[model samples]
Target: MGNKLFAAICYGENGKKILTVKCEPEFGIYLRENYSDITLGYYMNKVHWNSFDLNGNVPEMIIKDMIEQSINWY
Candidate 1:
């Protein structure tokens, strides 16, 4: 299977997703088109999200930065 990069804003008892981060396929993911300019993430459904595939095309640091940006999607 192709490696897909996904992310989501996670929530807890506090009632808000404290942060966002890369998500394993099994865990589900979301997407938000307005999140970034170059990159795009979309809402998976109601609560989870995902990002565009890295496809091993960009450098590792860029991917890392994308993950970092996702983490700050709060």
Candidate 2:
């Protein structure tokens, strides 16, 4: 068997997902313009999702705060 990957998803009252722990499009664009390791989310809505290279230049605290903000959106 092969390994599997899962995402931490946040859902709305309507049972629709508001955001995943992944990055958002607006932030992604800003990060990409300023950092080298930030990119659009794979297998996700490009206009609303983003992926981050944890080993890259972004600070850990910033990432944490971003995730928190996403959660608060729900």
Candidate 3:
């Protein structure tokens, strides 16, 4: 809801049951409402994927954190 990077999904280290971040072209970040669709954004394009390009300025740890966070959410 808030304009910030929130936890999208929570996955295990096993790589199973992956989590996802909702990258809406407008929202700029993921939100709880996105869960309703149950679809991980666009099918072909990663436009809606948990874009590690957050604002075009992201650190490697931040990106890793997003992935880890997603796993936890799952």
Task: Give RMSD to native, each candidate.
Answer: 13.6, 11.6, 11.4
Error of 3 at 65 (Å): 0.8
lDDT of 3 by residue, 1-74 (tens): 34554444444345434444644434324432333323333322355454332333445565565555544432
| Candidate 3 off by > 4 Å | 1-49, 53-57
Pick the TM-score winner. 2
Q: Which ten residues in a row have the lowest lDDT in candidate 2?
A: 1-10
lDDT by residue (tens digit), candidate 2, 1-74:
13422234444345543333445556767866776655565456666565555445667776676676555544
Q: Model-by-model lDDT, in order?
A: 0.41, 0.54, 0.42
lDDT digits (tens) for residues 52-74 of candidate 1? 43332334564576576545544
Q: Best to worst by lDDT, what's the order?
A: 2, 3, 1
